[model samples]
Target chain A: MAILNIEPNIAQPDDFYEALIDMHRDLDAEQSRMANAHLILLLANHVGDEAVLREAMQRARALVPTSSDVSTRPA
Target chain B: MANVDREYQGLAFDYVRSPDQDARVAVRHPVVVVGAGPVGLTAAIDLARRGVPVVVLDDDHKLSVGSRAICFAKRTLEIWDRLDCGDQMVEKGVSWNVGRVFFQDERVYSFDLLPDSGHRRPAFINLQQYYCEGYLHERTAVLPAVDLRWRNRVTGVTPDAEGVTLAIDTPDGPYALRADHVIACDGSRSAVRSLMGLESKGRVFRDRFLIADVRMKADFPAERWFWFDPPFHPNQSVLLHRQPDNVWRIDFQLGWDADPDLERQPERVRPRIRALLGEDAEFEFEWISVYTFACLRMERFRHGRVIFAGDSAHGVSPFGARGANSGVQDADNLAWKLALVLAGKAPDRLLDTYGTEREYAADENILNSTRATDFITPKSDESRVFRDAVLRLAKDHPFARRLVNSGRLSTPATLHGSALNTPDAEAFGGAMVPGSPMTDAPGTMRGHPAWLLSCTGDVFTAILFAGDRGFDEATIAAIRALGTDGIPVKVLIVTAAGATVPSVDGIDYFADDDGAVAARLDARPGTCYLLRPDQHVCARWRTFDADRVRAAVARATCND
Candidate 1:
């Protein structure tokens, strides 16, 4: 299996992070969550390699609270 | 200036009045085509080329009223080339392959449609639908086998086991006639389809669009421009294309609740046009129309002696320009099968493959068009959020740009799983797969420069790329022995780049020249290909044998 190659491959990493945050401005808590879910799925589909995608998913999931989804996460 | 007026004055062509109805009532003609539009005319012309007598009936003598179906795709052009009009169309059409898509107020990206060369036709051309019909009309006029009647409308159709009886309404009077086959080339609102109790079943899009054709003097390049939520057209999309005769076709998306009547008026639309093209941009309104469409197809395209071609078979939203393009394709796919069946060369079941293949294409067009419509006019907030995100990401990211499907431009449909196709029996590589239409390449025919596809109709063509051992007299006899009149298959021996193949009585010879044809087909010197009359591949192999070629030809004609 191929290892994940997620080491700041974007040309301008800081600008991409700023753009992601800017997308959520002026939105309520629920809208921000929906936008996050959409961005994840969009980026996942773009990175169609399944092994790399699973690695990215696992790495991101480790940072979030396991019980954080009980009340607020999208179904 | 070539006159393009607001009103349509029908081109003056000699309209030969048919003889008295009583005199021709009992004679059953070989083929009768209803609705002498582009599709019907193409079907009639192709049949006449194969020595089939055809009768074409049209309600009106003129071309289409508005500048509808302005984009002619490459495959559609190739089909027209077979009908003897593709070169003239490319000359008269405004050819372009670049398209720019804008999101909100910012230009997201631009793409080139045809990056490679050596093909006969370009990726796409913008020609008014009426001009297309006019070209078909002029070409059909020279063929005496086609009897075209103006002011004649097929009012009723009666189909039986062997033939069909038609009641046609004429300017002089109503007349009854009979034909061995009836091909309905009528438009989407097919009266013949309605008479058959077939309903075009699909959800009517709540969305509507306004199409305005304008003649203007502008320096903008001939490229397709699409906008999503521009500052001028707020909260809606706009598409602009350049057509021949200095005419510009523009489409504006209006919400479901927009008043169609008020939106189509020139006075109300001029300000919107001015906002996009500056206020001082002087332009004359040529035509205006409002359309709302659905993706629909008949349950079947064949009904015994009665067959449907063009808009009569299927229809889709106008986003991808699939309507007229697919209609032309429908005629191309049906004409050869009908000619063979009428000649008793192939079984009647061969006609069944026409419905199967074209219906497959109709489904593909509908699927793409419906997806495009949804992406352009997203239904809910959830969908719009993703659409905006994709558009926003596309500005800088290369991968995101490919996901943006304003309209996946029209391309040729592969007749996958067609009953008439024979899968390869030997090992091979790269294109020329069964059911794929053959790609065109520049080559020399006899001693003259020619496009390969322009030489491919009228009979089943087996292109034999002969190797060092060319073909001995016995081998040549084996190739000739594989065909009968019922399933006529002809061979073309394309020798290697420098080798010369001796020309025989009926076989055509061509050299690959710069190896473009061989490179395009990924073919070696020993490769052999069997193509249907319409230029779609039926089977291919690396070696040639008489028995295998005969079986492949038999399968292509459905001789069982």
Candidate 2:
């Protein structure tokens, strides 16, 4: 069995999304990035399992294109 | 149609001069309530019914101008039933139970507010706020102890340790009055609140909405329809509701940059209505106004001896219709305690519970309305994206349906974790726990049909459930011997056996042949629930114990 389960788990998904949006309401770009970093660190600490954290990071990174690939590709 | 139009102008209650205005000093009254709107009139009538004299003051001589607060919830109807005006409201209002939601042009999900049968009132009724005020005003006129004075504006309120003194301005002249307690039910722009230098603090949404009451003959079903980002109006919301006398209330959401004055003109408003109701809709405008709402409330509802109720105490966005409904409930929670305190039966500390409990309720209303408002009007682009995603997903998945927020309709706030509750000693199974309003069930009282809620009088009531075996002689005698301590406790015995018990003095019997009451209350053979004057459960037991009941009553009244 997997240690991390992330398949539509929240009882009130909209409330979580709302709170997340509200958290970033008044922040600038730098502040928003810092807030995201802090939030990730806090959530990672709560996850505790190193393997699960590594898997989450890999899954999150796979969704975005690499900077070098985007630079070399045509617009 | 003429009568409805005339009510908009208001039947003038001519300004009458009271002898108190000519007194040497400020004439002292027992209780003085400010404002003649639904909340104030409710408080006055409730107090007068309890045999406490109340003087109600209002700045205006007629009903309010527009049809504000069109939705009256079932809980409000129940409170009106206790106050003797529910029949009139139910008769004149348009009752509805079904509500539909639409994302873009396609229907998302529909809901039945009252899925269960056997309820006395429908889930909600759409009536003009003026009609509610008229019914409450008619009820107040018959109550001898309620002195409702029109055009009596309270300009100044001074509160000392003993009581509150007011400076009133009437058409005849100004007058000074004093009262043991003052209940302020003034509207959101409360002069009394400003006089005290207090303010309500909350987040104010930047968008404005146009409320138009259009008179037309149409065949739309009497159901609440809400649309989000429809083709008629893109990137906004629209709400359609049915009122009495062929009047339909349509609310069109305008962005923050829309001009309020420009939007009220017929040229602008007519096109919007025609856009939603087609070119040949044939409708005449009954009323129109542009309003911006905020979710805020006073820090405390009570300041010394002056208590604020209604919009003066708290306010919410119009999405949930929680404003006037919760205000009337504030009066319901307050009147009995004030009556008891005035009669010297309970200590003054009991009145403090009203402030705390209602403040807790106000916080809940603010939170819910704020959430609904946030969903309806997203502050950020990301938030709007999330909201649209929820609406889109709601059309397919059941889990996402719970995320849709089209104003959770108003329901009675359960006063859980109140200071007045007696902690339970035994395990209970249902929702009728301490500090919860008792659920209503259809039953028969002495061979006549009645509601279980109507059987509870406006006093401390002990609802005894006779499951299989009837009550013992000792318990019945103890119930008969109650109230020697000056605070009366009325007894209502509920039996599911469908047979009458032996008649005893000071005890009423209810036949629950369908056993619905038993199932709703989770009652057992010897269970007893102690209800406050407001019909909230303060204590309960699996077995009948008169001593425990007395202790709970004492705690409920803040005597122990």
Candidate 3:
């Protein structure tokens, strides 16, 4: 069986999107990045499945133009 | 400007002329302790208690200037109690146990350190470093063997085959003194360490912290409060602790680039205080300092006839309050071994254990303080992201709360796998392993109130558990013989709750009223524990055997 569900999982996708945007309302750019990081960690913990998180990470990394050299990438 | 608004009256020791200054040749002493800070004073008192004459020299004639180290842990308090000053420290200091952690504007959680309490001392006590040094210095007055020379400095050190000779300087002039052993207790910028050409090596943190002690009449509960990215001080962390005399200590995390000199000024500090407390809040500054700390230790604490203890040997950041607390523990671990060596009862190799054991403890402290420092002031963006994530999630999830590291707080390091310990031959369960310190429990002694620790005096103590029935004749005879042996061992017979025990002239008995002592030690009917002079358990057994106890004592003193 597949560990992660790639299907549309959120029942109310617009409500989830609205709440996520609302969380970053008064935050600056640096703070918005911090909030995003916090949200990722919280959701990852809530998921509580390593293979699923790892699969999600790989799928997400494929969408972005990642640098081949790890050291060259911004922290 | 420092300590100008202090409530406790500071003490100044008068610099008296030492008769050794006029000696034609250097007078030989058994042991000479350099520096008169908390560590040196404690070493002097311990040596004097063990019947060793120690000459404690210091360049200054007063206690520490400001309230540098305010958090004294339970283990340090017990060591002071053995030195005969724990009561004064606990009485004068503000004892506290609860600690609250906050994220942004909300308190995430609060923790009680001493949740179950039969301990004589609290989890921690916040007392000014000056008051602690004063109490320790005062304790040395009654010790006739302690030759505490004020305003006398160790200018030079020369080690040789027999002993170490120290060149001293005083207001009168300079003189030379010889000692069989020299214990360097002078702090971080140790003069003795430099004179010996030894260097402490480790990582240096590139962050600075500003500490301000403000006296106010606000009624905040006596608890440690820590905030991470609070609105009052955005992004950085802040720690608040209540000290005695209504004084509060506030530590603001300043990044590596902040100017230390400008940050400590009242004009710069006033706005920060006003932001934390309201603008109309009335407060007077007691002390302010901007300091950067490093986690480091010397390669070895022992060199030939000279030894290093306290901040002279190891140093950690103040986040965990491990610097002074660990230094005090170093003195505690070394004093007994040094005394035995001076008395010619233990082999010279025994002193090496002090180096190894406390070096292990130093590494532990350094590791903990370094981790806490990294969490408080993240070195990189990724680390900061993870730290903030933990702080944010800790408010709701218990698992995330475990990831939060404000400070582990100071706890005694069990000397696991120490050479002095006799390996366990029987199965046992408890925190009190062979190399662990004895846990304190409250009980009655001879119908009066007493504590389990108060019974373990400065000697080899064996605590025997008497379950329903008291000890047999052979066991009692063996304990008596051990008491009269070459190395006398004191016995404290612990009877179970309501169990009757016959009074013996030589051995003392404690009634375990609440069964806390029995539970803490995992004791059975004939279970016994052998504790060293410093109160660290060296051996234990399911049944008492005279030969095993004798051999264990020998091993503890490095006779085997």
Candidate 4:
């Protein structure tokens, strides 16, 4: 196992998290969703645990309601 | 009647006896963009400025009504300058340099937009979306390379391997159009996106919001005024912002319980606004609407020949003004790439990178908006209490003040796995290196401001320190060879007493205290950092000469 530790400096977790939230709110819906997934992936990569990532993905997927009849159109 | 007949004859169309239906109108353009909104118009203008021929199609008979996005960030204005419309936008837009945040009934925090250095843009400008659209429309029309078609709607879009075929309904009649590529900038409910069957994935908040643009007379200071808890209403309150035209854009979070229809009543809205103002302020409503939006993004932005841009790709809560700005950025990202591909300067694989890069940016925005929404309207009771406590602490603690001042409410875009990222070396320890800004600096990268290499001699070199063993001659020669003519090259290797060995000479070397190196590089030993053009790190590697570094840089610089 490889461990990567990012120290607290100018870009702290609080600051990073808050910045992420702010950017997320500012984006449109399409960009926001992709941004959410990207953040999860980036943070997951930071944590670096496949099992944890799998669990988080499962939890996130569960949080989203399954709409079978919903159209999968691009809009 | 005879004089009128003479005048009408000049403007009248001559009717032919018989015409063949097989006659074709020939107009071949490199790219044909549909929808002349901010995204489409920006794309056209960017492509046209790049000397690429573009034809824009819009169904709108006239300019759009109402001001959609009134808050423009500093970065957005900078982009407008690139399009040569910054001065006009700034002149007509309201400047907001200061803002205050309220918690419960008290002012929890206040901050200024002026940072120490490095930001070349202002804090924010509040301009009407219509004005932005109109400005771009006017500029795009004058360009000979750009053909603007108003009152024309794309009725059907069909894409094949060769190109895209569009069925357009003009005021004249339905016409068939063909182009190499079609960029869909038709807002959130994009017809092209719908035709392609792409799904937008995300959460829709249950809470409803009412945005009212009103012209009112008040003694309020010219600052972004926010109320967490109005005395009359206990829950999350209103956000009042002054626009350019003496109109105040007020946003109220009317929870799922409120009646949206009744809330629209001027009688009900007037008193609530008066309560906050503490006086009978006369005002006329410009526009009012109750909207419930979900933070959703398309599963994919491109499907074969059709590419989605702006709201067609993603939608987020407008808490931090990221919605419109990000869309404009989408155009910025796509325009350059498309121009390169059309000019045969880069491979088609570069197009695939649009998804990788913009998706990362989109995700960042989503997280920021979600957190803001949660903070503004905490879901759980405990979370609300904690947030309130944090807000109170922000008043006294410097750390809290810094946190509040940084506008953590909006996340900056980070390029991780994009065309601009380079592979990391083992010594870098999988951390991102600093890149140069996108100014006319001697060594700045062309596309994005993210990437680590800075121009030294004839080649761009990544600065590195030896935590492992130091660089060898062969790798140094390779770095030199890679440094083609007109490209500067220099390698500086720094070795610390207890540092590990570095495996590559492509990086500039230096010898210093491990602490000092860590502070400068913002990383530890055995780490390879990838810097962007803006002196920001895009990616990093823990071990020296990681495989992904070269590939990332190659993708970024059109080398691959």
Candidate 5:
């Protein structure tokens, strides 16, 4: 086992989360998309494991709303 | 050290009546540069270095009043290095890469402008514009080919087939001069551009900023510090940067309604300064001013023999440190091309490439600064909401951090698809691509420590990279034939660690030890690169083709 267990990997996650939010703060649509792409590559490099990255990608996609899933939300 | 008035600089270049001072009439010069600022001085130096005599005229003899245009990007440093004053400026300048951003009171994150070492110069250096002006002025004074005239105001410009004639007004009186070629490096309100009825077209940003220079004995490290809605200023943004001479620059973004005169008053500025530096931070005022900028440019940089460079050619907001930096590059780009045309090395039509290449750089600087300005000063309610949301998210997530743009620090403009470049005949992957400034790599020349760019000194250079695969003497001699004693197109053979140097006169050999230089250039065996006088890689190949190399060299020099 690769020991990819989640035990609050980053200390002060709240602070880290705030910093991330600030980074994306004010970018236009095209820039925002590029930022997301760059962020993924950066984090993936840090993770550096094909299996772990695939698992994380799957988890992320599962949480994202599809077109069909969007109809369930309040208009 | 001087008076606190922001409008005047204590140091100035000695303004003497020009040797061309014919009070009754005019004088004819080979080249005339309008404006004695950094850009004009650079253009004059480049021309003089290439053997074209030049005369530089300026309305004022003093350095820019404030600590203006503080950040010198690496590419600009390289360009300045070729002009013979880069080392001096770097020695006196403070170099740094760390930039910190704060949202409200909490510190958000910090980023490195140049994360890696192993290069000739750093990512950025902070030096006052006055220091740069002083060094350039000193360098220009010693040049035999340049006649720098101060307090010589140009009032009119009339262009003709042979050249252009300028009407000047000096303290002694008015006179006229004819120039084979004229370069407008005048400041934003270019008299030459205006006289020629040329106008820069673009949107003028409504937002204004108050720039203040303060000096104190604080122990803060020299780095860029930017704040979004900082606690002291409440909703407005503030930026703090340290410059040479213990001077600190502070820029406060004042909305459209800011009272221009009122904001610059010492009374109004003191409270904010106190809050930002703490109540008792004892700082003496050096200079202060309010300014507005627009990201605008002329439709074309070249108008026959009367070409425009610097702020006269284009103007961008000061946020990205692009104004003076890009303008200096314009001077560099045009100097070599103009020199070639003047010396009959290339056809007159070659001058048109200057406009095309510099226009590309101007557009890039404008685009980057525009985006940064929009992000910094959101115009609409929707934009403000989005900005605040991003800022809020930026504090927490790495993804949000990527969206932050505090004026993406200036980088070298890649002139992709330039007309001067020879497009790669074969697919390749490497740093030294066609139309890109040649990247520096560590190596030894003649068995001594050196970098690749040091060999590219102010001439048409061909770097023949023959690694483990040895080169035949005939081929080496053939390449060497392209250069003569008078027409030196330096041909250097680069080989990795102890590869026997090919025996050929007039062919320089360099050892790329440890393969660091070769790998950096992405050069395999038999790779050859042709660089322009500006050290920009104009053409490259996987294998050497003697005839093809000759043609590429000709094309690069505008000889084809």
Candidate 6:
């Protein structure tokens, strides 16, 4: 099993959005694709509502494709 | 006798009967700041920027003499940048990052400030205080709202519920003037403070220090060099700092019994300095003065409508170079408060924080200067023995080596008992609380470390975690109410997995980021943050509660 380690409990939507924008600005297209997926998932986990997390996951998946070769994990 | 116009700069003057003849002319301003020193000039500039009419008075006929405070810290430079003078000051100042200490002709320790990992500004810069004053004066002259009145003095000051009135004495004549507020930037012997019946309370050290500014021609390292002991001066030490104009500021720790008259004589002091140099080097003395160190702080920074700033409020030994720096900060702190109160943006209670906060900083500076003084001049025999032992140990121990090598020794100001600060149970546990000094991190507040973040589209929101599981829905609703009439809050709740959510304290429940969602929030749970206009923390809570968080925001931004 490919273990996807996600750090839970994202605080403050404003700060989360700022981090997202910063990552998008700082990272390249390929890295951003991978990072955005992780960010969305992390944000969903903090949401803690399983239904909301599922809906956010669908929105995130449409934005960035998750690949088997690539592991969606935080460094 | 020559006559000069005391009203405007560059205006030539005709002869007058006497200096008192010029004192008859009266000038009026909404706010009058006494003293044209660095603190007074800076306050005038800031107040002018806020469109407050100001008149600055100084009794001195010319700029100050000597190289009095040559060191400028980083935060001060940032403030200078706001005044549009940072680039000029930085260009003219010399940057030094390394320092060395010598004990008994042997180098005891050395340290490098460049490797400190993250510093927004340089460790230290050396520029003569005269240049700083001249730069500020030149800038203040261009500000139309600011009037610089040289050779003007306030002989008396009286305050009532209405405003502050000053009995002003100009070279032309004496006049009575009234101002909304009066700021005293006069030096340590502040006549304003004396008239206010406030006393500076602290210890006065007996030992006298001799500071000499001289032009030296030597191939010495361009760094702060200190000799702990000299052969001829067994108990005394020598301190040398390089200045911008190729001049050197040299200080000698003279014993308490040293004769001031003989020390002032070049014949006696010059030989002693020459002997330390080993070879007979030719140098010209620019200025020399003997001063005793006193760690004193005013009991209260304000009395009625009159406010005390800079040396008038506090005095510290020169060892840590905190005197001038802290004084400038006092001016910075007070100027903004006075401007706000005058402009009617904040309540009168905001002015109360200036005394509470600045007095705390003044006391901290006194403590640091006192420590430096005690280390340099051991008061008791036991302290002397211990200092000597530490110097000996510093020669070999790596920890001691690190301590001795970094020549700059001063503590950063802390926010405790500040009217702006709120109580935090886990403030020391790495949570970004309100009133803490701001740091430069991507998610942190820009100027202050508080949690005020604004999104790209101008939508503002705060983030809180379940650090103590204390927040509830009502509190969140209260904070959301602060949103603009149209802009609704998008709340995001962060909670630990498998842990029971605690009872609501006051925060509103938002969406949680758990499992894959956690990757999106990017913030740990149990952490709460509030952001303000510039995307900085207005307030933060470890546990959640809507009402408390909203109240904190209101308090910080003056909404309440």
Interface RMSD (Å), each candidate? 2.8, 10.1, 1.5, 12.0, 7.4, 25.5
DockQ-derived CAPRI band for the predicted complex in model 4: incorrect
Q: Lowest summed-lDDT stretch of 10 residues in model 2 chain B?
A: B1-10
Candidate 6 lDDT: 0.65
Q: Give model 1's docking category.
A: incorrect
Instruction: List each candidate's DockQ score.
Output: 0.19, 0.05, 0.45, 0.03, 0.05, 0.01
Distance from true position, residue B324, model 3, in Å?
Answer: 0.9
How well does candidate 3 match the true structure in TM-score terms?
0.91
Query: Model 6, range B311-383, lDDT digits (tens) per residue?
Result: 9999988876787777777776776667767777667776677788788888888877787778778787656
Task: Return whichever of 1 and 5 wins on DockQ.
Answer: 1
Q: What value of lDDT does candidate 2 attain over all alpha carbons? A: 0.88
Model 3 iRMS: 1.5
Q: Tens-digit lDDT track for model 1 on B235-267? A: 899999998777899899988999999999999
For model 5, the local distance difference test gives 0.83
Better structure of 2 and 6 per TM-score:
2
- TM-score order, best first, reads 3, 1, 2, 5, 6, 4
lDDT against the true structure, per candidate, is 0.84, 0.88, 0.90, 0.64, 0.83, 0.65
State the TM-score for model 1: 0.90
lDDT of 1 at B488: 65
How far off is residue B373 in model 1, in Å? 0.8
Quick one: RMSD of model 1? 4.7
Candidate 1, backbone clash total: 1
Backbone clashes in each candidate structure, one number apiece?
Answer: 1, 0, 0, 109, 27, 76
Query: Taking chain A by itself, what TM-score does each prediction score?
Result: 0.73, 0.81, 0.77, 0.50, 0.79, 0.43
The segments of candidate 5 whose C-alpha lies over 4 angstroms from its true place after superposition are A1-75, B1-9, B23-25, B485-488, B498-505
What lDDT tens digits, residue by residue, belong to model 1 across residues A26-67?
Answer: 999878966775677577776799889988778878877768
Error of 6 at B39 (Å): 1.0
Regarding lDDT, does 4 or 6 come out ahead?
Answer: 6
